[model samples]
Target: MGKITEFSEFAEAVKIANELVAQSAVAISARKMGHRALTVHAKPSASFAPGPSQEKIAAALAPNASLLKEDPLPGPATPIHDAVLARPSRLATPAPKGSQAAKDGIYRGDKLANALYAMCQRGGFSGALIVDDNGLPLAVHQSPVPEEAIGAFAIVLGTALAKAGKLLGQHNAENISIDINYTEKIVLRRFMLGQSPGYLLVICPQEVDERGEVELSIEQIAQILKRA
Candidate 1:
């Protein structure tokens, strides 16, 4: 009976750890994709006082910060997603050409097409794309985004996001969801797959209050990727 309690505790710990890995993956992906919404609310640099240097204060407090310490003891083995998230800096690094990990981490070809198609068919979303870490599309479903231009768009947007985060010192961003009020409302959501640096971009019309459905569908797609 005592052992059963221990087993339950262990199971609970594992579950929490998995959740952390998943969140970390999303954060890494968000950073890589250059999600701008995450930093939209950050206090402007111009607002800082012209007093003592912020750098000095940070340096003085550095030693006491937990993040400044050596890496913690190894946790559960990191899968591709966790590994990519573990090194937040990797998002800024150039992807190696011909590297198998980058190629294989998220299976290519229409692997994600069906899921994306289903999501788009649910209504509101105009299109969807499952993109790899490098912004190359693995699957594109009904997106007006031209197949030839997807990669370039991803790279440009990601670079912008990373630059903004760095300037604001908000290096960890989980995902980017933005609603643009144009002639027609447009919603854009960008999030990472749980097992890789891969990303999912969903673009939808803001009409008809379909935000909840869109969110649920994206989450369902993430779960499916985790099991894949």
Candidate 2:
């Protein structure tokens, strides 16, 4: 190749400079148009924060000054016996004086409690609880386990079992029996007391039935409460 002439070199350089200027003008025009489009087409938006809306919802749901005092919901530490003795508010209240339920010998108070204790002793039960359909204890007999705890467990577990039965098309589940064979066997029997929707809950060691004495004690308790 020969050495390029100065005129030819100057001509090539001028051509490149013109091309670059034209391209830069096009780029500047595109950027200006883009900026104009963004400014003109963009819409103002109203943003919402979750905090305010959530606060409003919570305030609306909270109890107001006019709201009345409500009864306690069914849950742990709700004091079952106290609620049972609170008032004659439950529909299954004791039979009126001289009425059929009264004549049938509806047991209550210390007499009923003593009877339950004796029944537990006779059956060698760890604990026993007689509760209404609402899971309120009418009578409880203590042993190694607290009667209140046994009653609560019975209501919750038995209710779950009954619901499970109903879901499987077995409505009005009459009994829920659980036997746990661990270091020591634990047996729990919950059955509907005859006639009423009340329940008779018996918790006893597996050994209690080794001699086959539990069945008789249960039968006696059932017979006694059937009149109630």
Candidate 3:
């Protein structure tokens, strides 16, 4: 009886081990099948034959050969409708050659401001202002710095340069430049506005030379002041 019981226990243990081994084998086979399914599904099926030959492709495109020659493939997409093609472009036109005031032969404070604004836009200056000798801003356009502070500083610098030039027995300074940094500088151009000394102060990049713009601005300012 004891031998029979031991034989039975050993047989049961072997059966369990064999069952575990079979389950492990089945799991590995299932994992391999899953990976193969994913790989097979991820790629185009091999059952599909290759594309048409060049001769067949040419035959297919022969009907539209003239169109293909005139306008190649991958050109701009066609507009949805004739109206879409006919619609006027919304792109902004270039700034006018000169200010409206100058063209109309009308000069006023607002017109002067507009002219300055146009000048700054054309010249690409950071800011510009027309100031009196007392350092008061007459017209300002897109002033990057405080108008009053810059106006006052422009007057002070211009006065200092003028005094220095006079002391050396030279002509009064007409243009005074103050370097703010290596990249930017302030330019002061002295002009006479009906017997009153007015200054055109422009802040621009150091490399930009806007002498023509400055001169034009001076002329415009003189005309505006005279008319005012």
Best model per TM-score? 3
Give residue 82's error in model 3 in angstroms: 44
After superposing candidate 2, which stretches have Cα over 4 Å from the reference? 1-107, 143-148, 171-173, 179-196, 210-228
RMSD of each: 24.0, 33.3, 34.7
10-85 per-residue lDDT for model 1 (tens digits)? 8898888789987775344434443222111111111111122334334323555332243221233321222212
| Models ranked on TM-score | 3, 1, 2
Q: Write the per-residue lDDT of candidate 3 for residues 1-228, one digit (tens) a residue.
A: 577647878889888878987777433443333221110111111111122244433433454544334432122332212222232322222234597645764335455666776676667666677777666667765454334455556676768767877797656668888666555667889887667688888866676677989998888778878876
Better of 2 and 3 by TM-score: 3
* TM-score attained by model 2: 0.41
Model 2 global lDDT (CA atoms, 0 to 1): 0.46
TM-score of each: 0.42, 0.41, 0.51
Winner on lDDT (2 vs 3): 3
Off by over 4 Å in 1: 1-111, 172-181, 184-188, 193-196, 206-211
Across 198-226, the per-residue lDDT of candidate 2 in tens digits comes to 56666544434422343454565566566
TM-score of model 3 (CA atoms): 0.51
Question: Positional deviation of 124 in candidate 3, in angstroms?
Answer: 1.3
